[model samples]
Target: MSGFSPEWLALREPADHAAINAQVRLELVRVLAGKASPKVVDLGCGAGSNLRGLSPWLPAGQSWTLVDYDQRLLDAAQARVARSPLSPSPREGGGTSVTYRQADFSAGDFAPLIAGADLVTAAALFDLVSVPVIGKLADAVTANRQIFCTVLTYDGIASFLPEHPLDRAMREAFNRHQQTDKGFGPAAGPNATEALAQAFTSRGYRVIRAKSPWVLDQTFERLRRELDQGWANAVRETGAVPVREIEGWIAHRLAAQDAVTVVGHEDLLAVPV
Candidate 1:
């Protein structure tokens, strides 16, 4: 299993993430209504990023369960939550109670972990989860008549620097690799949003879908580097051409970013159904 490397965090670290994610959270809050505090489960809740964004809007009495298969990430998330002002202490208004579970949504059944939640959500998770697995999750949540929301899955396409020939080739190769099933019984990777939506709709979810793509410009240097690396790795994995040529392309592209245009991604927000 590929661990969540600092490289991943570096890519995710951005001032805009907090604001953009808050917007996504607010959208979910708008649709889910209940007088009593609702239970919430954040599947693949890495380091509690979404929790940080959602806690303010949720009622003080609401209960939360955070789940991630990675123990290191789960521990980190626990620590972050405990340190936040919203900690279960009375001073924080005691509006929300939180719990963290280290479990893989792919292997462990989510039904029990998320049972009875007014809302169950995942950010950038569905793209990595297989269709069969997603189907199971849809069944589990629908069986309980719960709402499910997933955001920001890759659409197997990303806009890239204009005038860069290698950029298009790399993206095409990576997207193809993303479509392969990674020993998970069912395929995941790219095109995940469409598949998940179809699964939920078929399972009787009233699906509400939206797009939230990342159109980061050269201003986002770190994100730009990560995107380049991601594309390079995919090109390497495919073994479609000479390794040296791919490396050369990556180095050249990275160096040429000053003038090269970059645009990539198709983000999707899918609600239950």
Candidate 2:
């Protein structure tokens, strides 16, 4: 899969943190109750935002293995995690320890990475992978009996305030673009949540899913603008809609007053039954 820039990852981290489903996180915490030094593997650990956001809720003395295809991102994640107050302090006994690995799991086996992990997690990742990739991950997690949690699997829901005539078309086209090869075969895209649920449930795992939508308003103007531009680009790639119409749609969206966008996502937790 293509690597995301640190800048884009940084821009989205706050929204990602804010959008986490409280109930799903609580369930994850519940499953991880007794381990003083739990082992976690974070796939595609972009800037380690997931760690920064989730570490405080986990057990003390946690050890994390952060894996990504890009060494630069891995480095950024390590540095960011080390500095974040939300992460466990770097003091002796109760401090959290982190290891970074550069690997393109898309092209090779990732089973080894999660071999002894108590929990395997990823954020904003599954939606870009193929169904077979998800199945492979499910098999690995189930075989190891590791808890699995993934958040921000887009659900094809994009609603913009002051609705425009071309919004639906743009959204549909963009979703189609999402399914294009993202270095993991045909990407699951908006169908990722259902794919994940089915994959785990069929393996006798109990699955919990909750909505984790990004409710962007005026306060998030920069992110909102960037998101709109991204959508427009994806829609253009599909060629399912005219370029002029897509451009006009984005212009209207960006220029509109008090615009709000709700981009739907889901958080999934799969625990051994």
Candidate 3:
């Protein structure tokens, strides 16, 4: 319910799954392989896309808790999980039991167990949070010696093929709008990965960072258009560009061959000692 539409989440899910770092995933799997039944808590889980993407990578007898502020998304996540190969109960051969909770992570509504979950997972979330919140997350994960795997955190990198003259302005304005408080105070936006990594590392956790940029070509026409429109809306929100230029830029970008967009994101895999 972070103002992100279900359509948008669905549109981006495939790209997110592909963006996960192979080496980082292997390291995380190795670390959790020893747990009899690993417990993973996904903060800010929207529509359960993270579960859909990562559950296959985990052991069958694991438990996953999906937390989000939006009840509607939670409902959708539960319903979708039921339909997915990762069913709610292990009895369904999913080898995983899924649970959903309506909670506000920014308000710190979770108990110690969630904070120190065996594996703390988040996707497309850190960028919307503040430094202090990330510090608190680090403290809890360190306290329980847990593994933290967060992916697709926006890193302020974007490019539009058949580049427009206003690309730079659009990106800068969008990034600035990203920094605006999305419930969390003064979001780190594109800067979240670095700040979160430093927080975890400073707390004695070993961390690895990997690039997970989204590379889109003409085949992904709808997703590409949405991304472009999303940026235009954000830039307009920031009042960084004139309305006429914004419309012109968006119109021009909408029609192009081999239209490719690389939106930069990073993944962090940290294991507390």
- Predictions in order: lDDT: 0.67, 0.88, 0.84
- Clashes in model 3: which pairs? 60-95
Error of 3 at 153 (Å): 0.3
Give candidates' CA RMSD values in order.
3.4, 2.0, 2.4
TM-score of each model, paired residue for residue? 0.84, 0.95, 0.94
Tell me the lDDT of candidate 3: 0.84
Candidate number achieving the greatest lDDT relative to the actual structure: 2
- Model 2, 1-273: lDDT tens digits are 455889999998999999999999999999997877999999989788888888778888888898888888988887786676444634324767888988888853769989889999999999899999999999999998999999888998999988999988988898898898898999999999999999999999999999999998987878888998888888888999998998899899889888888899999999998
Deviation of model 1 at 68, angstroms: 1.0
Runs in model 3 with CA error above 4 Å?
87-94, 109-116
TM-score preference between candidates 1 and 3, better one: 3
The worst-scoring run of ten residues by lDDT in candidate 2 lies at 84-93
What number of backbone clashes does candidate 2 have, counting pairs of residues 3 or more apart or in separate chains? 0
lDDT of 3 by residue, 118-222 (tens): 889999999999888888877777777788999899999999898888888899999999899988789989999999889988988899898888888775778
Candidate 2 deviation (Cα RMSD): 2.0
- Give the clash count for each candidate: 11, 0, 1
